[model samples]
Target: MFGTDTDARNAQQPDKPIICEVIDPTGTPLNVRATPNGEEIVTTLSNGRQVIPYKVSYDEKNRHWILIGDSLHSWGWVYGSYVSCLSA
Candidate 1:
């Protein structure tokens, strides 16, 4: 019953935002790239940092990359494997 209220509210709102948290296993900050698997490092996210995922992409090696930010702006691309997402 703890999350029942929140779940019901989310169920009623199909357009509710999805929240993601950084979960890098290496215990280091996760890099946010300018592009999927690109050389440019736009920023970094620490473990447990929350972000909103907007889109997803795959690299040549099939590595999953997620575009994260808010509705009005995008932060950058982060490795999908290093993040855990939940609907909020």
Candidate 2:
């Protein structure tokens, strides 16, 4: 599982629902991985798709990754750089 300090910080915060939109500049569907920066793609999200961020982790290169889904189901992880989140 994710064990980054950023992930720890997010775990300490209250479970506030934050909505984020996929904004892949290439206009192609964004790959949702099973782990941060992982090659295993669990799914794909198109631009404008709204998702709820459940957790966050940063990779060694400092790329941000978010765990996204609804309240009951977790879709997977996506590169945070391609997502635009609004304040909750």
lDDT of each: 0.75, 0.77
After best superposition, candidate 1 residue 24: deviation in angstroms? 0.6
What tens-digit string does per-residue lDDT give for candidate 1 at 1-88? 1133343234234486678888999998999999988899988989988887777777888666778876679989887778877766
Q: What is the TM-score of each candidate against the true structure?
A: 0.77, 0.80
lDDT of 2 by residue, 1-88 (tens): 1244454345325665457788998879999999999989998988998888888787899877888887688888888778877647
- Candidate 1 accuracy as lDDT: 0.75
The regions of model 1 sitting more than 4 angstroms off are 1-16
Which portions of model 2 show Cα errors greater than 4 Å?
A: 1-12
Clashing pairs in 1: none
Q: Lowest summed-lDDT stretch of 10 residues in model 2?
A: 1-10
- TM value for model 1: 0.77
- The TM-score of predicted model 2 comes to 0.80
**What lDDT does candidate 1 reach at residue 38?**
89
Clashes by residue pair, model 2: none
